[model samples]
Target: MSLAARAVLVHRTTEYEELLARHGTHGQAAFFLAARGRSVEEVRERHERTSRALAEVTAAVPLKWRRAQVERADLDRFLFGPEDVVVVVGQDGLVANAAKYLTGQPVVGFDVDPGRNTGVLVRHRPADAHRLLPSVTGVRTAVDDLTMAEAVTDDGQRLLALNEVYVGAPGHQTARYTLQAPSGPAERQASSGVLVGTGTGATGWLRSLWHHHSSPLPLPAPTTPHLAWSVREAWPSPDSGTGHVAGLLAADETLRLVVESDRLVAFGDGMESDALELTWGQSVRVGVAEGALRLVG
Candidate 1:
């Protein structure tokens, strides 16, 4: 909590902003939404609320502290100092989006429109910033170090995600690969993809996958130092088997995969644009990341 520490405010472009960008004008954007039976006024109100919330949070920062702003798209290019305190101003997914690019820096999440986004990560409001900022800087508040997932390839490419990491084909074509569980025999499988998720992700895409597939493994809690993995739609054929479909990976263990298809992809937290590509015979290892998200309320 040094006085020289910087505060990095993180945010994402809103729907209204996207509409304006796409339509080229407010009137056109309104007309576009009107055609879809959606009201532009509502979108504008939410955008204004987000703007006010961001302004309030910015004002709440200590006057002496150095501050900077970064959009979600620029996070990969933004440099975060060791003593930086990250302030995420958006939905829970935005927190995940920022977490991958961060190290051990503490994060404060603020929800702009709570009614529309009842997220688990964004648990605070702009009004709480004044009181919370001091606690975060002083290290006097409770912080939850949430576990995260990692995917590393043999060629030195690595990716991290706050929720989960998906490894599969680039398109709808079946992903052909050999999956080796942490403590069992490897199995050649053909299916949609493979998903490795953390406890924070268990409530998201992982949950949906778990519901469809029954397994003896229990889902990890938010702070658990473990990961859950599952293969989507494993097709059992003469060359491929579905013996290893789901399992749990300990913090020290890893699930390995070897590509048998022409090309495969690995992405985290649903950001497919920023992903890792693998060629035939490439290998990847999925496990719990060494760094965890330090979230402060």
Candidate 2:
């Protein structure tokens, strides 16, 4: 940390103004990190607008735009200097990936969807980020609850999502896949597709299905524990058909379900995976990530 460095504000177009007004002050030099994916002109215009707005408040306050072509090292050099506090206001994906790379620093993410911002925020370290997430920033809405936003991946590595990760053919037709689990075995399902939901994913498509486990049951206190024994156990149905596990289904990284025999393919967070493939006799591991991203609620 350096005396020259103060707080950094990372935001999309909708959030640029208020964030500046909140953090930019007399002594603090506000550093701005721009979002990626927009055209160069658009980015420049936004940067100019943000800079101008900050100037109106205090001309001496240095509000500088991190150049659009800036790389990860550039983020390191410019954003996280001593005494610098980083404020992220856009997508979390970019934020998480960037947070994963950052060094010692204090960071506060302002927006709700940090996942989509990975294109810009992937340069920081995840452990360094803390959520100062707000429900409303001057009428710009943000999801304050973790459930409204996508689930955080275990190890804070990725987003938890199952409904959007279906496997099947293209066109107006629906895709299908076979479902299997270690304890439950296999079952052939027919519909738009099959979904594998984590506790975070329970509210969406998985909520509509009958067989999926919604969430882990809360345990009773140690002193209140009753003598419980199972006389007979009933389990879900078994099947021989094929289907795809929806939500963040990374092939090699998440799980590797057998798809070689059924022409199965995996899609993750609604995008096709080049890393994962279906194979025979391969046990597919799917569940919640190693941890959860806590919501303010």
Q: Which 10-residue window in model 2 sums to the lowest lDDT? A: 225-234
Off by more than 4 A, model 1: 1-3
Which RMSD values do the candidates have, in order?
Answer: 1.4, 14.2
Q: After superposition, how far is residue 279 of candidate 1 from its true place, in Å?
A: 0.6
Report the C-alpha lDDT of model 1 over 1-297, residue by residue, as the tens digit.
355878899999998999999999999999999999999999999999999999999999987779999999998899999989999999999999999998999999999989778668998999999988866867467899999999999999999999999999987469999999987788999999999999999998998889889676799998999999999999999999999888899999999999999999999998888999999999999999999999985
- Worst lDDT run of 10 residues, candidate 1, spans 132-141
lDDT of 2: 0.34
TM-score of model 1 (CA atoms): 0.97
> Per-model C-alpha lDDT, please?
0.92, 0.34
lDDT of 1: 0.92
- How many clashes does the backbone of model 2 have? 41
Clash totals in order: 0, 41
